[model samples]
Target chain A: MQFKLDRRVHYSKRMLIATPVIAIALAVLVSSVLLVLLQKPVLLTFHSFFIAPFENFYSITEIFLKFGPLLLIAQALAVGFRAKVWNIGAEGQMIIGAITASAVPVYLVDSTSALLLPAMLILGALGGMGWAAIAAYLKTRFNANEILVTLMLSSIALQILYYLLLGPWKDPMGFNFPQTVMFQDEALFPALFEGVRLNTSIFIPIIFTIGIWLFMEKHFGGFKLVVGGLAPNAATYAGFSSKKAVWSSLLLAGFAAGIAGMSEIAGPIGQLQRSVTSGYGYSAIIVAYLGALNPIGIIFAAFFLAVLQIGGDVALVSADLPISAVHVFQGLLLIFYLATYTFVNYRLRIIRPLTHSNTKPTP
Target chain B: MSTIEFFLAGTLSAATIFLLAALGELVAEKSGVLNLGVEGMMAVSAAVGFVVTFESGSHLLGFAVAGAAGVLVSLVFAVISISFLANQVASGLAVGIFGLGLSALIGRDYESRTIAATEGIAIPFLSELPLLGPILFQQNIVVYLTFALALCIGLTFKYTRLGLAIRSTGENPHAAQALGFPVFLIRYCAVAFGGLLAGFAGAYASTIYTPLWADGMIAGRGWIAVALVVFGTWKTGRIAFGAILFGMVSLGELIAQSMGARIPSQLLSSLPYIVTIVVLAMISTNTARMRLHAPFSLGETFDGVGPR
Candidate 1:
């Protein structure tokens, strides 16, 4: 109704911090309606949709199971986002990383070691970085739009995954599915706890996230990159190369996404499949933004989105809402997030002719 | 889809989608607000357009509705990025995400159902020409309009006073602002125009190509068009060239699959995106060209309240 922003408020910090919460709240409200559409009671559905996911350790582990790669990709995109370099190909990078990391266990199936798993993880990270670098170089050198270039390049990475899985990586011993040979026990990620589907890959994203957060907060390198993104002229005057910032941010993001891809393949998936793509990269775009590009925030956003995902699947089985319906809910969440963000930023006004008859300003 | 026929169809389809969108983007970039939500706008428009055509069986009305729908969505992006001075990338990303969700939700009923699309309007004698004839002459009226619109847009930018004003606004908004040009209005107009094209592009894909709506039906075509704007280095001819090449690449995957080629089809499907990178790298390699050719005001939102 009016400009009600508090003068004493640290508006920037609050806006940044509250974005994810605001988005989640909006997502819940929209999803509740979707539940109603599915013939479930709104209150009951809200309880089931949001509350049920966190009810027990079984579901909590399920959260972490989905959270690992999402957190990784979100953090990765956050790095690029911090420097204003958007890498929207985390899904492609994830698939390629999975495919490449799967190379070790699938090819070297007989070879077994704890060392092999870590090595494969490193390879996956490298693969993602390698894939991301293509777009980064194009951006830095050719001055191409990184968002478009990176997104397009991601399709290429996905194709590589399809080619390998359908051809070279096809599992000979398994049924006629387009997939790779299963990894050896040594190449598999060790579980963090027994009786849970989640594995140790969750630690990879968290460790990288802390390292990134520290790098952004404490290091001059990140400061320079942030400055370059925020104010190019000032950054140039300060002698920080914008090109380097773009390359650094994108490369780091690529590395993280690749590693996340690796963890997904090695940890839970064990074998590569076409069903590997589940919109992790694109969804991470939401996660990264909703988290306000913060490491600590991404951890929570990842879990929340993972819950949305698993809950969507649950709603499909229990509520009998199809995947399309769940997607509609997700889409609505994105819209609600944007819509509410407008309110967060600006207070709308309804202008009317000041009629003498109805001229009372509400006290 | 044979080689010649496939190529002809793909190029026409690509032209229709890219023409107005790129032209609209050209104006915006010239003014300096790089909007990435074109894909999202297009996706939403495609759905809206399909629905309209499904109900009305009129391509003209569908195009109008789709363009209006796109503008409505883009207006949200424009206000957020241009007026409120929110982060352009963030605002655009929000616009895209919101539109995508909106499209999927609204388009649920139309999914998997084909609708009557705009039919090819064959040129009398030209249609009977050699292999090149149908590919070039036997396109729907939208195809001709898009091609002609590119010429008009390109010529206007190069020759007209308004074009100069738009160019100046993009090049140095502060200077233009000093000279009394309403930079924000110009940007709004440019964005709205771009949105119109983007929406029409989506309609072209839905009503023309696939003819049936599906979730994510536009596939990454919107992204490809955005990439082409860059790959073209902001030149109308180059953008059209890039788009046609992309169209060919898109059709090539289908061709390969149809030919019983054992090569993993996904690899071929990725050709368009890969080419976008390769072409962008080659053309934009010259820093001077990038600096000179890039729409001067691309991506930087104007606060109109003096520089922060």
Candidate 2:
């Protein structure tokens, strides 16, 4: 007996929505087995892993705080991914944005103008776009693989961040620690609610989601990009320049990732530090996929992923599970989702081996 | 040993890790599959190898288990990317992320643990030779095996039918399949073989090179291995050279820092990754050359029913 996969002519909308749900269920089941193997109680671990994050108002706000960056980055990445122009180095771009945005507070420490915040956000977006432009230029001119170039560039960005923090950017008055001085009141983001760490930046992703939905669903440029990805020959025949698609996709992703980076320092951190990276860039990739690369889907996906992160932390203290187990769960979610995504386009069927007649032997 | 000798020895040991992994990736790519999870595979294997060696007190067992662990993880990759026809790049990334998390979880207890370091065996009579003896004749068994493996791969590609089949499959899977070759099976084996080598590389890092278990000890060597394949233009000899070059670049930082160079340590630390990007760009810019050497179906999914 053999199993065969038959390609479906059209993917059903129902499966499109159901696949992620199924993948999550499967991932939870697998994690339960893993928890058992580790000698942790499955029920208690599950409660901490999935349920504990929403147990309080503060933790709920924390989830939104995490969601802000992830959603922004994922939405940005989805644009590029849809165009088949992968910009995996959003992490690097985000870092550059953080640096650029922080330059305002670091250089103009005494300035308290209200315009400073908007200027920093713009500068942050520009910084990210500038970093992504390197990959864009290499990809367009030199035909370098964006995947490798972007990934390598991310490491370089991290190193640069380390260099600045440990050297030039180190706060002189802070006892030689490798971090920058806290931003002034004007540099920091205003909190969205009293006594909550969540800031106005949360609205950034919410607004971008609507903007992305319009851009992807209604804009001609987006249609061209989708054409380029789905069928390059068709795109070329229609006179849509692949170069423009690549540039637009990367720049947009860079811009969004930059905003995310700026929001981190401006919102929760209020200071530039090495820990600002915190895997937001990488996690955004999983979020982008989990959201099915749609604006609305990305909002939910980002929220789900953020909850996982917060829940993972809570579980670390309450369940005695290693913090790394959270990372493992994230990884498993992606793998499982990718595996189940196949079902959206293909159905499995069992096949029996055909028997051959022995007429020649009888003769 | 003089600084030069020390650098050379360090370069050999460092290069061996990349050489092993890259050679395996080269084979997998030749058979028309790309496993970007090399970093993750190495990380997991490093952790697993460290724990096994620490508990069993046998480096051989550690190395063996590490290779098996790599294969096991890669099998997950194969099942998803190959069987399910998922995007190869994303699948590889998932595997890598999974490996990292799995390694971190497994190595939680083993953090900061040290093991008996594997020592290089001195070749009889050759140890008496000045300068060259310490650099070449005295090295760990894996270092010698790397050289042998490179030679064997080169010869196999040039002279063997299996190599021809793999090259043919990578070039045109449809043609290979129509000609009765089992494309999926070949790719599966190729990917599995890559995993085994990656595992060995990881084990070597934890048990021999550093002789210590630490989270992320493999660092970015796995990614370097992936880049080396492209940098070498998929050639065994060039891959070996690229590995040695990267190994030297990585060690150069330590040498510079130890010698009290005033450059920021972070800049020095990033040299290898920077060089990897630069080298990748340089090699990839020559499209004609890349087309000539890169497997045509390198990352394309074969669903067993298509002409493509």
Candidate 3:
């Protein structure tokens, strides 16, 4: 028995080390077959994917630009996931935030104040929270499935974006286009450097990282949420309200998603549109898990995901890969990451079937 | 306004897709695993069905191809989670993501492609009835098939030996194993069955309802189907009712828009999600309120080997 235990532990350790490497090699091999079908050179296609993202500074910056929103949303999701509160519809919450925060500059575009941008951003966060709270409230009050509520809300948010773009928020000066009016000088997020899309949005992520780390490390609320997830019955016995934890985790996610939404519009697009709420809200779930649901780890994971997005775009333009190929790569990464963990905490064994006459016979 | 007529048409339309997807999820949930790839499977199948039907002009061929594609993707999920012992939640999510990606890639050429759909297969005498006519008889074959499937499923649960084994595998795998039932085999079959149903649902949405393929045509309906299982609280009868309610809400916005109602159409469009949240809250809060339903061992991953 002792010998078997040691062998099993050693086997697991080896599997853990080789798992990601093996999965990536397999994924790359599969992608090569796909490329061959596309009548593209597999060697060049492979190079353009793994190495080209880091080949130039220009591409690197673009990667960070894409990583910004993913970082924010993934961090938000990690909070709720750790607490076991599934907020699957960050896309809807994101759109709500973008629409809400854009309200300041859309109607009050001319208001030049030091506080206008900050105030609008805060409103954006509130919008995301408000959207998430609907799910949280329903779940807490009625035991509604948060997953469905969130997913359904995302579609509704898409419709709402279309309505806004077509109706009051439509750009009057433009031709027949589905987009909101561009923000004025005051509303646009300040760029930190010229010729670069990078801006104050990076600070939001930095602050969130520190805040989440400290909250998880030091705060009572954070401890309760994590503990609630690890042992729900113990939490209840210890007088912790599972409902309170649910609200906090959900509300925090909303806030983070909301801010990310606002950042998307204010920093990059500088306007509200149907495309404002992309699949980042949903993809962040993968990002959260890939980061191992840890605050510090998520930062690296978010950045890595951002690189994949950038690499995808680069491969699309230079290597002649379609947008779908990048998405496929992302999917491959998710599958590999998820599959690798099988070797983490589990040990496998086989034994002969039990012999019992008391049990009912199978037909 | 003939609200009853409108509601009936809307509900049946919704039921065609929801019933198919929800039934598949029901089987998966019953097998002690939650595979959240229903939405992704639907999306992949939707695109595949659209492309096939567009080329062959045969709805049957398209439906079959879609189902095969869905099963193929779900097998990957089953292999990772069931065989590898990967976290079911994460593996399912990965499968869903992969499905979406695969569908998008394979169906890229079929974007904006339109095809002939599965039209209503009307029953003779039933179609003549006033209220129940359009409600039941005048719908496509899939809608009628759903009712039959529901009945057969319920009967299988109560009377069939195979059903009993499936149930035992879910409730207690160790007990099932000692009794000579292969728990893993039962779960594998259940999940694959779910994939087949989900594929049909996706194909139905693409071929019959929309008759066109888009990147995100399934949207989040698969997720909605997952919640339906919880709301039905695990009873096939109640789930059918719950699926109809969801279907109605889903079609409500379109019905309102078609009728040219004065409501801010966007807010009305969101009613499905709002109702989903409300219904879910109601069902999940009180065990009794769940209508004495819910699978005995839903979403619990069985390792197939445990202490007796």
Write down the worst ten-residue block by lDDT for model 1 chain A: A1-10
Our model 3 lands, by Cα RMSD against the true structure, at 5.1
**Tens-digit per-residue lDDT, B127-168, candidate 2:** 668998888889998899988999999899889999999998
The TM-score each candidate achieves on chain A is: 0.89, 0.95, 0.88
Estimate TM-scores for all models.
0.88, 0.97, 0.91
lDDT score for residue A3 of model 2: 95
lDDT of 1: 0.76
TM-score of chain B of each: 0.95, 0.98, 0.93
Pairs with backbone N, CA or C atoms under 3 Å apart (clashes), candidate 3: A142-B281, A143-B280, A143-B281, A144-B280, A144-B281, B233-B293, B233-B294
Better of 1 and 2 by TM-score: 2
lDDT of each structure?
0.76, 0.90, 0.80
How much DockQ does model 1 earn?
0.42
Rank the candidate models, highest lDDT first.
2, 3, 1
Clashing pairs in 1: B31-B170, B32-B297, B32-B298, B34-B299
Q: Residue by residue across A1-363, what tens digits does model 2's lDDT show?
A: 899889988986888899789889988999889999999878887788779988999999999999999999999899888888878899999999999999999888889999889999999999999989989988888788888888888888899899889888889998988899999989988998889899998999889988999989998877888888666788889898788888888899889988999999998999999988679999999999999888899998999999988888888788888878888888899899999999889989998776576334664
- The C-alpha stretches of model 1 lying farther than 4 A from their native spots are A1-12, A23-45, A232-239, A322-363, B1-6, B116-118, B130-132, B160-162, B254-264
Compared with the true structure, what per-residue lDDT tens digits does model 3 show for residues B1-308? 16777678768777778888988888777767689889889988998888888888989998999999888878888888877766777788788888888888878888887876566877999887888877777788877887789888878877899888877776767788899998888888888989998899998999987799888788778887887888777678888888888887777776777788888877876777677767777668795755345555555556655742
Error of 2 at B26 (Å): 0.7
DockQ for each model: 0.42, 0.80, 0.57
